[model samples]
Target: MKPEVSIVIPSYKNSPLDLENLHKNIANLDYPQVKVKVVNIKVSEGKKRIGYAEAANKGILRNKSDLILLINADTKLDKDLLKILVGYTRKNPEVGIVGPKVYSMSDPLEVSPVDLPVLSFNKFFGKMKKVDPLWLENKRKPFSVAWISGSCMLFRRRVWKKLSGFEKNYFMYWEDADFCMRTRNLGYKVFLVPNAKIWHRSGASIGKDNPERIYYVKRNSLYFLEKYTLPPGVILNGIKTTFLIFVKTLRYFLGEKEVSKAYIRAVFDYLRRKKG
Candidate 1:
């Protein structure tokens, strides 16, 4: 018998059309609907919007399936995506987390980052590249990755419990990386199953250019970099933070004040060790 599966989706003010479309997609999926449980934690437009980390944790904890899938509401999982991801995990007992090869919804040719080396603050600014020859060749099989994007990840219940779910401190950005690192440290494999794919509207949940989004990303990155790297990482993070502050300062004078302040506040808030 196929193992029970639960999809935990964290959504914030997504359009009804999108929600209808998501359910429509889910309807088309190859997995048996009877064996699959879908949990949608829709967030209201409140004065304080809950973070994805917090929302996702709630959803994961709400399920009791053998396999828990964390997927974004702004994504279209291929018909076979869930089936493939579950198949990969079931065949490889050592695997704790697995995600599909994600394609940008706007540009199908573009592949999202997953198979890169473990994240370090210094390499965080590397340019995004398109699918290369190596990427295509590897798509035929599942491959281990440093981290899988939180946009869509499948996790075993035991592993989720062991890691205590996403670090609520992250609140949103980079929590996926932190989760994957902890998963790897516990001697479990985190895989990117290229055979399984999804089209994602990245940053749709949080405004792509929102000041709040920038703040969380910059601030949360500091926590991740600080915890994962040694002394050198701290030094690099400081340098990068300084550079960002300077850049944002210039932007402040150039009429990009709100966004600029977001970046500035991110540095200060990280220094103060503030979190959700």
Candidate 2:
């Protein structure tokens, strides 16, 4: 029998067109025994929402399944993904979390590369490359990662309860990595299920280089490092990353694009304590 799978998508109020697109993609999935839970969080009122953590928490609370799959609103759901994920869990009961192979929509075949420097360079260059064929070829074997994309996050309900869900303090960034670390600390493995795959529209929920993204990413990096890693290493990494971003921004400026400018503006906004 198939394990009950609940797909939870947390969405903020978006243009009707975008929502239509998202609905169409998820509906395209031909998976059976799936329950879809969409949690729409409105940003009005005095209530302060704690970003993805709150939205995901709400969605999880409303779901009724032993296997909970947290999907981003901007992802194209792959029907076979559910079965693949459940199969992995069934085979490896010690595994607490699993994420499907995520491809950027612009370059669908480009499986995320193993080289951090190359991946980071691509982000700086703003060029999406096709996934390395070797990476795709290795999907048959189950492997582990320090973290996985939250775009297609899957895990057992019991494990999620044990970890107490995402940390609300991290409004938008590093929360997934933090969760992976916690799971590992508790003596569980986080695996990347390559057979299960999805395409992600990068930065769909938040526009690219949006100041809000910068603020949360910056603040959350600090929070994550402080809370989970050695202070010296975290501080050093933070400084190094900031310096590299600065250099990359300058390089982009000479190449002519407002994206670089936007990125610098965001950094300034974060430093100046700009909200949202």
Candidate 3:
């Protein structure tokens, strides 16, 4: 018998169209023992907006399957995506989480794998890059990665229980990295399944470069740094990342003043939260 899999999609009212497409994609999957559940924040709580972590946790708590797959409403999966992900976990008990080789909806041929966290210029950032076609053709094996994008992730139900679901404090960003880091610390490996393909409408729910997105991303980066890094490293990285945010503010000052203000407010917000 196949292991049961539960797919949790956290979405809002504005994402209904995209959610419809995602539903169709999942409905056509070749896998038989799969359940798809959508937790609509707007409809469930009578609120227009809710944190991604909270919405995802809602769906997770309702499901009692052997494996759980968390995917974005704007993502469309290939027919075998679930099958491949489930296969990986069944084959390797040590593998805690598995994510697919994602492709941008605009460019289907391009391989957009989630970047591993990198420390550059004395600051940390997710380093995403399109996979070279030649390199992809040469290397077909699934490889271990530091972290995978939250757009689409699969993990054993036991692991989810162990971590107690995503940290509710993280409203939107850095939550995946936090979960992956905790999984690694607990001795479980994260892997990327090259054959399981997913097409993502990047930033579909939240417009690209929107000020609200800027605020949450900047605020959460600092929060993640504080939680994961040592005292001196956290302080140093905070300083370096703040400098980068300053550069961003300067660049957006003229055309997008709100974005600049959001960046500044993010720092203040994080600082205030730290103090209290």
Candidate 4:
């Protein structure tokens, strides 16, 4: 028998029409024939809203499937996407986590397999390139990566039991990479299945380059770096990464004053958090 699959989508809504397109895509997935369960996780409590990490944690704890596919509401849920991902995981028990080669909806060729968040200028600022010409030959092969975007990821239920899901405190950024690192630490590899493609409306759920995104990303980058950097490397890593932080601030300051302010505040907040 095929392992049971459950899809958990964490959405923050302004109105019911918020997930209208995403719902339509799911409705188009031939639900009558497909056997997967879909759980729509609303990240709201009363009038206020919660973070993606908290919402996903709740969804995972509530579901009881053999496999879990967590995706954002802004992604195009292709007809064959779930089947392909499930088949790959069923075949490779060694893979604790798997994600697809997601392309930007604005441009299909541009794909990014998330890299490990190491303390380096290149690691944080470098952009992902388009798929290889060989990919055009339709050789949708699987490859290992340090991490992949949280936008669309698949993992076994057992992995969730072990890792306890995303760190709820992270709220949004860096938690995906943090989870991947912890998963690998348990002797399981994280693989990217390129053929299992989908389109993510990049920055649709949250505006691109907005203050919230900028602040969370910068704040969480520091948290992630501090967590991963060992004792002996802490001082050196802090000095080098601090320089990159100012460099990032300068780049944003040249473009938008508000964004620069958010960057500065992120550092201050993270520092204050450290002092506490």
Query: lDDT for each of the candidates?
Result: 0.79, 0.67, 0.76, 0.73
Error of 1 at 139 (Å): 2.9
Instruction: Give per-residue CA lDDT, model 3, range 1-276, as digits (tens).
Output: 677788888775446688778778888988985455545443236544557887888888888887888988878899999889899889999999998877778777765533322212122333224344447544568987777888899998888889998887877887888898788878999888888888887777777688878888889977877776667777677678778777867777667678888888888899889311
Which candidate would rank higher by TM-score, 1 or 3?
A: 1
Q: List the residue pairs that clash in candidate 3.
A: none
Error (Å) of candidate 4 at residue 85 is 1.0
Model 1, TM vs. native: 0.89
Native-vs-model 4 lDDT?
A: 0.73
Spell out the clash pairs found in candidate 1: none
Write candidate 2's Cα lDDT for 90-143 as tens digits.
Answer: 899899998887776777777634211111112122222333556554557667
lDDT of 4 by residue, 166-273 (tens): 887788877888888789889998888877777787677668788978888888877776776565455665676688778877877688678878877888888888
Candidate with best TM-score? 1
List model 1 lDDT by residue over 1-276, tens digit each.
Answer: 677888888888677777779888988989874467677876543676677787888887887887888888888989998889888898899999998877878877677543232322233433223345345545677777777678889989999889888887887778888898899889999887888888888777677899988998889978877787777657766887798788889989999998999989988998998987
TM-score of each: 0.89, 0.76, 0.86, 0.82
Who is ahead in lDDT, 1 or 4?
1
User: How many clashing residue pairs appear in each of the predictions shown?
Assistant: 0, 2, 0, 0
* Residue 61, candidate 3: alpha-carbon lDDT: 88
Full candidate order by TM-score, most accurate first:
1, 3, 4, 2
Segments of candidate 4 deviating more than 4 angstroms: 13-18, 30-34, 47-49, 112-139, 231-233, 244-255, 274-276
